[model samples]
Target chain A: MHVKKLRKNTFFSLKGVMLAGIGSLALSAGANAGTVRVTVAEYSAKTGPYFEQVAKDFEAANPGIKIQFEVVPWDNLLQKLTTDISANANADLSIIGTRWLVDFVEQGIAEPLDSYLTPEVKGRFIETFLTPSVMNGKTYGLPIAASARAMYYNKDLFQKAGISEPPKTWAELEANAKKITALGNGVYGFGLQGKEVETDVYFYYGMWSFGGDIVKDGKSGLDSKAAIEAASLYKRLIDEGATQPGVTSYAREDVQNLFKQGKVGMMMTAPFLANQIRDEAPNLKYGVAPIPKGPSGDQGTYGVTDSVIMFQNSKNKAEAFKFLDFLFQPKQRIKFTVNEGFLPVTKAEAEDKYFAENADLKVFTSLLPIARFAPVIAGWEEVADVTTSALQRIYLGNGQIEPTLKDAASKANAILKK
Target chain B: MTAKRVVAPYVLILPSFVLAALIVIWPVNELAQIASHSVNRFGQLRDFVGMANFRALLDDPNFIASLWRTGIWTLGVVGGAIICSVPVALVLNEDFYGRDLARVIVMLPWAVSLTMTAIVWRWALSGESGMLNSALIEFGIIDSNIQWLAEASTAFPMQILIGILVTIPFTVTIILGGLSSIPDDLYEAAALEGAGRWEQFRHITLPLIAPFLNIALVLNTIYVFNSFPIIWAMTQGGPANSTDILVTYLYKVGFRLGKLGEASAVSLVMFGILLIFTLIYVRLTTARGARA
Candidate 1:
């Protein structure tokens, strides 16, 4: 790998701090270790087993270290976190969504961990996790998991239609969808999330693989042929028999149900669904693929850096660093992430004997090289709003591409400046 | 009793007032302050943009559409709910072999969470595999399964339709309770006047229950207008912003977009609209009562 030269030199290198404090701060939570309470958005009632396992393992290794867990919802996750942080009552540990890292950095809710992490810890994970969380030349958190979206397909449906493999390009994907739909019995050939929020952003990025993007530099990327073509491609599947009829009404769980029930032939979904399908619908044969290439040849898939950052106001940075040390090792990281459906950050962990045995996970692991996150700007949440609204109008059959995309870009650029 | 009431009353209410300040009043004042600024993803309130957030919403085409859509939804769902509920309540109030059973069935939607109800209906109304659409096609009412929640044209109506199911239960119970309070004497007096059932309802029954009906109307209208979960879990105001109401739109701005000020402003607009409608309703109803 090439190390790009810095345009300007900073005298304080992160590498310098790690070596200086390795012994003083490397305190793992043990007999003398302090408890670090953490909060997270709940995934399931079964989450207890995973958390218990992680706590038991970390505690056994670190001696007296412990974890306190509180789970909320995706909708209220940020608000709850902020309320705690705003009140100076934030958790010692937090399992925050990757999308939120930038906003936290801006508010000074997170501590700059450059003063704490060892170079060994930094080198162990995918470099992208650190890059997105880094700002103004400082690292905020060590990521526990990296999530990316992929197209999941039912292998049985494809084989029955005489299709031996999943499509590699947008055109072939559409064509295969049509064939699968032709097989009939009211089966849809494709599924994609049209829900509002970050989920909607993923669908747009998937389309960007064919040459559509919501932003280009400081301008609208959605008005071009690529974006319009991408929009039309989705419309075609809806109009054709390739996708669930009411896909527009689908939330993440709704799509999950359809895919699990053998209703949808192809779907753009999270990597975790692969794990879920194994438990809920193990009889179903499935394969995962990268979001196909568009005319631009730059395929699109969203990666998440599920990171843990210290609240700036916390009075317990010493204990927090101890928790970070116990958390970073892949053994606990893999247990927390894989059970939660997140991909491991380290290449070795992604190819761990456990995840390696899961065929569908192998597909997600394969696509990690091309994964990119949405632009992590403070106003990005607002950009997603404008983009999702515009996409909704397009789907309604009344919206035009150029006007909407231009408006979106203009608004986004202002956000970028802020 | 009145001799020692003054200081005693003040002491009695002090704790309640303190709790109110801690819960409702504090949050409300805080909301007003927060509503004044565009907060970032973190909780810091940004520059004082004044009412620009509210003004921006006025200019937002999507907000305007949601405002109108909410008006239609409130009126349609509340209106349909009353229209269907009153008659059913009246019937269930009458002598019948299975009246108790029917009333129990009517109260079921109220038993389940609105979110749960929306989920169940979404599945039954799903386009291809939905039990409702599939059954309709099976019965030969339509050639193929229609996407009830998928297409733009049908999305709002479908939401209203599902909303009606959950709404009817509440409206019916309110009216039913009102119905039980009405003495049979009013109907007997109307019968002597050669009045039929419709005539009695127009004259005797309605006028007697007008107070209850109006209360039900205001409550249901407000509830339906501000409702978020039903449409969210079902259509999420989607298939192209078709099912968006003021609340979901505000949520999009406030929570999802992290434009808390704009969301709060939108929420204030929603409150303003409801307040106006409520005042108008009270004035009209009271005027009619005075005349009577």
Candidate 2:
């Protein structure tokens, strides 16, 4: 009750402060200081205060410019942006998924940042983070945060199964999984994400590790040799009892839950799982490693990034760029990333001593160099669903590996053609 | 005075007409306009594509398959609902201990949203950790857990059962209301004629409840055909689109694929199909009523 009351009081005080700030701005209307309207997908309630503080700092530094924030909840950000795009009512600056950068560019909804960015600013970002938003030789967005996938294995389970080290190759991984399963009492070797959002991405960890991609030469890559091998690995795991039965029903969260409970020996997930494991299952001993390499010794992980984008129709381009420049400065970047629990998107932030000492983030930060992102093509989301369904068919259906993947490839090709 | 009379009726229904226009007619009109164009991922209208969108849907294999799946879904839900509810409604209509409590308990599934129901069932039917699996294992019904929503064979049937679960209470309440309105004198007369329980049910109860049953069938069929959240929240039309109905496929095409024009075409086709079914169903039942 006290906490709730304290929160309410804090909220009211914040409101009063904002109202007072607006009143002062209105009173000095003739000063010619302009406000850049900003909208960010609020990472949490704490983010609102941080943004307000940043706005105050920015205004203090630049007396002729002010920042106005319109914080949106993560769930409503995409929908709200779409509505705003159709009506030409978007805020001057907003953060959007890097996966969406291409579609937004194609629709002329996002303004290209090439003209506004200095060469020094362009060189500041980690090169891989900028690659997703670059289309046809034009950069349309700046990376704000990123996530990279890694393999999480139960150290206790490994020791119990007599494994001295985490698997470093696909063959070793499979053998280790079988060994772990052999010691099972309501335990599984691996927690495979068979269903839910980004089910395809889990499969892609293997596919890309084998040096394959979902798109190759502007067509579906599902039928490629690497992809087929990737699908076959999961099928074998399911058949050999190396993975839990009903692998097809497990989402990423479900797999994480199983792993945290020490019911699964291994899982490939992003770095966020480290925080979850620390808080939820402190007793469970675990190790993080780079994903097992595929047959050709190829290794990769999916890199998910969110970028700051400016709408083409915004009138406050100069002011929005000023805010973007300020936000991307090394000091501000570190603060934003630390609060957001995201991997740094800038080289300076990546090399920071704070990250080097953080053992949980060090594994992922090291893996950032080899991480690949989903293709930023239009209709990529639908194509991902097709791949997910195909993987489900292989795991849960009759386990016909080749034909199902080929069929999915054909379907994806058709979608891409549209 | 005639003008005043006409104006009075218009004024009385003006609010309803405006609401209808805003909610229904306007969106339908927009959908129709979009159906004839090439809409990009961001929903900006491109050049007019005429009937190409509809033609593409007609030729699309997934869309064609979902049509039959949708039919089976609609039929399964409506048939299962009627079968399950008639007995419950009959039992509820009787004088019993805690009859009011029984009615409310029987209708409880209708109170929860379909999305919540799906979420609960997803947990219950999960293979690794599920209450249903635990019970089945305890009873020695199966040696292992079933991935209920992962396989097509189980996913389709489980979705239908979920559809029935959600629709059954609505069916029961409507049928119960119809049962309540039935005059007891006819049942008493049938009993006086030396009729058995089945004879009374067949001769009096069945015929009297035909209109209500018809209403339930049409409404349930429509609801089942257009159901989205249950299927989406559970399986998302996975396992190679085996559980996909028209509505879920339409959702994928429109929202995920960002082909609003094609999705609008699918919507028009669905609308036309539902309209025809409702018309035929109502006409046939009403014709039987007139004959009776």
Candidate 2: list runs displaced more than 4 Å. Answer: A1-80, A87-91, A115-124, A315-336, A347-354, A397-399, A413-418, B1-23, B285-292
Off by over 4 Å in 1: A1-35, A56-66, A198-207, A211-214, A295-297, A356-359, A402-404, B1-26, B281-292
TM-scores across all candidates?
A: 0.86, 0.86
Candidate 2 has an interface RMSD (Å) of 7.2
**lDDT (tens digit, per residue) of candidate 1 on B16-79:** 9999889767866777777788776445777887888778788888899998988888888998
Give the fraction of reference interface contacts each candidate recovers: 0.52, 0.50
Q: At residue B162, give the lDDT of candidate 2.
A: 88
Error of 2 at A398 (Å): 3.9
Top candidate by DockQ: 1
Worst 10 residues of 2 chain A by lDDT: A1-10
- The window of 10 residues in a row where model 2 chain B has the poorest summed lDDT is B251-260
* Cα lDDT, model 2, residue A22: 46
